[model samples]
Target: MEGTRYLDSEFRFNSGRLSLDLAATVRRRASTPIDVLGNPNACGRWLKAAGLFSDVPELSAENEEALIRLREAIWKLVTGAMETRYPEDATAVVNAAARFPLGTPQLQSRSGTVSVVSDDPFATAMSTIARDAIELVSGSLRLRLKTCDQPDCRMLFVDTSPSGQRRWCSMQRCGSRAKGHAFRQRHELSVRA
Candidate 1:
C-alpha cells in the first residue's frame, strides 16, 4: 500500500517500548500535530514494520478506532506517570488492553529444528505493548521516561544510556539539530559583540 512507505520512513521506534513507539505516531504534540495514523492502512503497516505481525492484518474501521483508543490511552498513561500522577482512567484502559488474549506461541519442528510462531499475532502484539506499558508505568523503568527536548519534537523515549543523561529522542536527528541551532545562536551573538 502507498501508506506503508510513509510508515517505513517516518515511524520512529527509538522509544525502547512499543507503547511509547505507538504514541510517537503523532508528531508535534505541542503544536500543530500530524496524526500519522490518519490513514486507514497506516495501522496495519505499522504493526508489520514493528515486527508485531509477520503478515499485515486486515483492520476494519472499528478495529482502527480501537487501536487509536489504545494508543491514546498509552500516551495518557505515560504522561501521567511522567508527571508522578497516574490517572485512574488511563490505568484502567491499559489494564483492560492487557486482559486481551495474547497469541499462543507454537513450536514448529522442521528438518530436526524447532521454531516458534504466534497463532494470533495481532492480539499478541497489542497485548504485549499493553503489558509493557504497565511495566513502564509501575515498574522501575518509570524513572527513565523522558520526552524529547526539541521544541518542535514531541516524541517520548526511555533513557537507556549508562549515565541516563540522554535528552533527545535521537542523537542523529533531534540532538544534532538542537546542537547546530545552539552553535548558530552563539556565533550570531559573538558577531554582535
Candidate 2:
C-alpha cells in the first residue's frame, strides 16, 4: 500500500516505533479518542502498512481484541515509563505478548517478492510490536522517547535526530501550525504596542 494512504485513513505510522505507532491507532488518548482500527479490514491495512504482512492478512475477532489489549498495555507502559515507572499490569501484558514469535519473511514465486509467512499474523505482529515497546521502555532509547509538545497533539515519538531535540510529532504538521500561531500572536501584540 502507498505510504501516503495514511492521509486517507486514520492510521499514522509516524510515531517512530512499531509499538508506539500501534498505541497511536487510538488517536487523542487523553481526550475523546478515536479508534481507527474499527474492523478486520482496517486492522489488516495497519498490519500491511506496518510491514508486518505483505498483504492484508485476515484478522480474527479474538486476535484483534488481543492486539488492542497489547496496544493499550504498550501505551500505558510507555507513558508510565516516562515518569520513571512501569505499571505492573501493562508490563505483564507486554511480557506475555513478547513471547510470541515474530513473522517470518519468505520469498514468493519467481518474482521473488518477500512476504511474511505466518500461521497467525496477529500473534507475530503482536510479538514484534511488544518487543519494540520492551526495548523502548528499558533501553537507551527511553531517554529519547518524547511526547509531542503541541497543545492539541500528544504523540509519543523517539528523538532520532542527531541533536535529539525534536519536540513535535512532525515539524510540518504541528511545528508549522504552532509557529504560525505564535507569529500571529506576536503580530497582534506588536499592533497594540
For all predicted structures, in order, the TM-scores are: 0.90, 0.88
Give the Cα lDDT of each candidate. Answer: 0.84, 0.85
Residue lDDT tens for model 1, 1-193: 8956766686778889989999999988888899988976889878878777776789878767777888899999998899898888888877887887766555555555433356656666777888989999898889999999999886889999999999999999999999999999999999999
> Model 2, 65: alpha-carbon shift in Å?
1.6
Segments in model 1 whose C-alpha atoms lie over 4 Å from true places: 1-7, 111-121
Q: Clashing residue pairs in candidate 1, if any? A: none
**Any idea what lDDT model 1 has?**
0.84
The segments of candidate 2 whose C-alpha lies over 4 angstroms from its true place after superposition are: 1-9, 107-109
Q: Over the stretch 148-189, how does candidate 2's per-residue lDDT look in tens digits?
A: 888767878898999988988889888898899999999999
Q: How many angstroms is residue 133 displaced in model 1 relative to the true structure, after the best TM-score fit?
A: 0.4
